[model samples]
Target chain A: MGQPAPAVLLPDMSAAGEVSLESLRGKVVYVDFWASWCGPCRISFPILEQLRNELGPEGFEVLAINVDEVEADARQFLADVTVSYPVVRDANGTTPLAFGVMGMPTGYLVDRTGVVRVIHQGFRKSDGEPLRASIVELLGE
Target chain B: MKTLTSLLMAVVLCGCETVQPWERGILAKEEMQWQTNVSEAQLRNQIYASKEASSGGAGASGGGCGCN
Candidate 1:
């Protein structure tokens, strides 16, 4: 729960500019690397949305990066499950390489100080329990 | 003949090394998958199999047309 997280700055999918994990400093960040083709990612999308809405007042932010070669695929998925959290695209997948993301729905929970507290590999409906505990613990810290 | 024998031996030895959990980061990449682009590849393979009347390795069972 104390390793420094790698730097990640990617083009914003919802806007015309770039957004960096650096901007989310001082806030607990849930950095999720996902792709449209991954089935597990479909499960995590709504969980992240609920968490972001619930913990946003406690300075929690979700930075979801989509690594789809075709942006339309991501958009289609978003149409099914929409999220208000900041969404970004890493078409070249360069950011995930730095984070050592080996799977489709890998997530890094960064504390307010920008230290990685957890690396969750997959997503399940029941996973939100422990994930919330970790987020709550960090929020308490 | 010796080179061919060694090549066969190497092929047999490929699966001997078990990848450790910590060393699986590279092994987990999307591109490292057998089907790097599964959806697209699946559709393409299906179309090819249907057209050619020969289909295998598509993972799904063949349809009534005998396509893979």
Candidate 2:
């Protein structure tokens, strides 16, 4: 899991432009692949937002990659559960293909050096503690 | 005959394709479910199980009275 993260360039759901993973190289990034239909994502989003807010000043970033086929579903989901992090839309499903994502709500933790250290699949309430610990360790590094 | 059967089997297997995780949105749609109406399907299963005097094979287990 130490490989460099695959380049991601997708339409920014939060703003008018695009967002690229290359621009966030120096920060510890959590690249989360999610969809509105994914049940676990509803639980994961708020926790991820909490993590981002808590660790953001320390250079931790959560870049959400939405893989919803219909952009309206994603917008509806965001309207219900809001987050301040930059959310990008991979409506064509290319990013998940490049990442070889096998399940919904998968996450890749990329260290400050852009190397993927963790590939997390499926999220639950109990996963938050360990995930935070891992991010903290990477930030320490 | 054996060789022809094996060839036919291979050809049949070639028609199957694995659905990738990201492409499963269509499958997750309400219209794609085998039983879109959950309560109706459950009731049908319950009645069938009651008639057969069997339970627990499909979904939730229930008594054979069909009351469940």
lDDT of each: 0.84, 0.93
Model 2: pairs clashing at backbone N, Cα or C within 3 Å: none
Q: For residues B1-68, write the lDDT of model 2, one tens digit per residue.
A: 99999999999999999887877777899998998899999778978988988777776777777677
DockQ (C-alpha based) per candidate is 0.07, 0.63
Model 1 DockQ vs. reference: 0.07
Provide all candidates' interface root-mean-square deviations. Answer: 7.7, 0.9
Compute each candidate's TM-score over C-alphas.
0.68, 0.86
Residue lDDT tens for model 1, B1-68 = 99999999999998698542223434556878887887998687777778767565455566636443
- For this target, which candidate reaches the highest DockQ against the unseen true structure? 2
Model 2's CAPRI class is medium
In the range A90-138, model 2's lDDT, one tens digit per residue, is 8787889888898998999999999999999999999999999999999
